[model samples]
Structure formats: structure tokens, C-alpha cells
Target: MSLAFLADYANSDDDSSEHKDIIGGNNISRSEDSNGGQGYCSDKEDVGHGKGWWRGLVCLVIGQNSQLQELASACMDRLCTGTGGAQAAVKPRYVRVLGDLHISLTRPFYLQRHQLSEFARELESSVGGMGPIAVGFGGLSTYTNEQQTRGFVAVDVDHGKESIRRVLDRVNLVVKKFGKRRFYRSPRFHASLLAVKLAGDREMSEIWGSGLANEQERIAQLVAVRIDTVECMLGASKYSVALDRTD
Candidate 1:
């Protein structure tokens, strides 16, 4: 489906903040807070056609765990060191650090300020009965944007695929009510580890062949995470729904 609604708003003069696309999803990015948080605030907070609308981005927060962080660091180091000449081709800025990892539940969309409460309420009610999900990383994979301008290195979801898909279905119902695009069809469900610009198949192959792809089995055994919260971030504010149900 066309995400022109989000694309137009993202490119509009009113909101010019940088976006970091989610892995296996569309051009969804999170705004950084001045206090070093992931909270995003718009430049024209009061200028949604004079209707108080904000670009709403939704996803599940995979908080920084020591194990995951170390895994990311080690993998990056290997990529930079093993790939001899190819390492020089990658810029440091495009690399995703500890705080940038997440699993997106829906593509970005527009939501008015007035609907914030109801949106949060509906989202909470939808998956409140679900307990925490224990997810493990499968293998290292590569993805590029639609324009093929950027490439990403990500770890696909191994265990807990069905549980995550259930959450995606529930979130999409709420997203449709607000007239936003649902999650990608046949989503791969992963946490982006690194992003590079202009890296085509040859370049990606060089990086993968450098030894990162071979480490997948070991990586899967090394990293397993417990996800307990799904967060809804609207412009500068954030709301979280905990997965604490016992039954």
C-alpha cells in the first residue's frame, strides 16, 4: 500500500527531523530527545493544518540489555575488521548503536492530539492479556530501502514469531481505526543492527562473506530477550503498555 500520507508529512517543511528506518519495515524513524532519550518532538507541534495532529509512530521497545549490546558490538567489530577494504566503505554514522534497536509493529502514520488517549487505551486493551515474550535471534540478514539508497544488517526473529505476529495483528486493528497503514505483509520481524548507504548486492555480499553470515548460529545461541512492553510514541510524548498478564 502507498504510505504517501506519512511520506508527505515526513517531507513537509513543518517536520524536518531525521528519520532512522526500521528494519524489515517502511521509512519509520524515532526522534531523539535532548536529554538523550528516544522521544521525538516535532518542529511544528501546533501546525497540523490547525488541527493539533502529530505524526504517530508505533512499535515494541527492546530496551538495551547488556547481552544484546555486547552482541551488537562484537558483530560490528567483526564486520569492520574482517572485511579489509570493504570496511573503509562504511561510514560510522550509519551504524546503529545500543539504543536504536527495536521491532516495529506498524508503519508510521498521522494521529491528531485529541485521539491520543483513546489510541493508547485501545492499544493497551488489545494486548494487555498477553504475557511477556521470550524472543531469540535467528540469523543475520540484509535489507535495503525501496529507493535502494540504504542497506541494513539485521537479526531475524527466531523463537516467539507467532506471539509477535499476534501483537502485530492487534496493533493493526487500532491502526486501521485511525486510518494508518498496517504493518508490512509477511513481515520479517527483526532488530536492525547496522545501516549503510549505497551498499548494493556486491558490497553487501562482501560484508556478509567477510564472516558475519557464518556467525548466525553462534549469535542465536548467545542472544535471547524477554520483551515486556509495547510503546506508542507520538511526537514528543510516549505511552507504554506492559505485557504483565498472568492468565
Candidate 2:
């Protein structure tokens, strides 16, 4: 999503200002562990996208090395030879997570097993490590789809007790403006690196009650999305993305 869209998505355009640390205060105390223990931000503080507010915005992908950045873009361009052609190739958004973790952020949304194997090989042979790759199972009940993509909620919440409804509310709110087509018959929530698209019946059943695709329940799940970083750029490129964490 565009920064304009993101600012809106974060509901942070208000002129008011509020600052309260929830976990990591401006001190940004570091630890031997790279996860950087959660910092404090007053839930009441207006630290979203508002001007002058230190909402922990991350833009490392911008103004970095240009040559290595085109990695993903180059791949997409090559894949264009098959179907819609290269011009239609999907542009990848750059992002970096705090701490050294999985480095598989550039994989296509869905992937077949064989492709996943190839991706594993590529990662092992890659130049710089991206971080530990993130892997997950639930597709929703706690997520908002962004630009045909659904990512893990940045909201930080205890998963063992929180119901999935928490995440769904936020996700539904974010995607409400999208056309009906974006709503899948079975909207299973998953932030994919690579996978093949599934056939429709499109039933996405995670927790709660069954029959998701066609059933619209007032049910919702609150998800905690504690964002560590958010990188952005325009045009196409895979290598354009790089992951960096504060020391």
C-alpha cells in the first residue's frame, strides 16, 4: 500500500500529538537477544502517522545501495515471459524486521512445494542474509488484507489467550473500502513467501466457527501487531529490498 494509504491505514493523520512509551522508550535499551524487548508507547499517545510524532517509522530501503536492490524486480521481469508479460509483473515492497531472523520476505505470495524447495536453495546460496524467514498457518480471523496481500498483524498481543476475533476486526476495517472482488469466498489468512493459489470453495477455516467464505458473522479477533520496521520504494526490484535492525 502507498504511504498515503498506510498513513490512513494506521489512522494516524490527525493533527493531535500524544507520546507515551508502551515498551521501548526513546532509550531503546538493547539486549543480547536481537528481538529488542518490546518498548513502551502510551496506548493513549498519538504516535501514528501524525506529523512530528515519533511513530517509529522505518525507511531504510530508501537511498540505500541501488544495484543489489533490483533482485526481486529482476526475477519478476524474467517471469513475465509466460503469461501477462513483464509489465504486469507485481512490484515488491521493501521491508526489514528488527533482529536477525528469516530472510525470505521476497518470495511470491503463493508457492508450490517444488518452488519452495528451490527458494530454500536460493536462500542458502544468497549473498547477504535477509533474516530468519517467517512462517505461519492461520490465514485470518485476525488480519487485514493490504493491496491483495495479507500480512501478520503488527499489533502486539499475547497469542496464547487472545482470540482470533481481535485480528479480524482490524483487518476487516482496513479492507472495507476495497471492491468485493478482493473478498475471497474462503478468505484464509496467510502471509506467504511462496505457494500455489488454491482453487475456490475458498473455505478459510481457522479457529472459531466453520463455513467462512459465505458466512459473515459479527465475530472478530483482536491481533497484536507490534511493528519493528516498515520499508518502502517505488518501481520493480527484488534486490531493491534490504533488511536492517537497530543495534
Highest-TM-score candidate: 1
* 18-105 per-residue lDDT for model 2 (tens digits): 2322222221211111112111111223132243322221121112212212322222233233222222222233221112111111
Clashing pairs in 1: 40-235
- lDDT (CA) for every model shown? 0.58, 0.21
Each candidate: RMSD: 8.4, 19.3
**Candidate 1 per-residue C-alpha lDDT over 1-247 given as tens digits, one digit per residue, 9 for 90 to 100:** 1011111111111122344333221212233334322242123442232456666656666766676667667666665555522334445655544354567676656678788667777787777657788888877666655454545566677888998988889999999987887877788777765554544444555554545556655685756788887867665555667776643
Error of 1 at 193 (Å): 1.7
User: Which parts of model 2 have CA positions greater than 4 angstroms off?
Assistant: 1-196, 206-227, 237-247
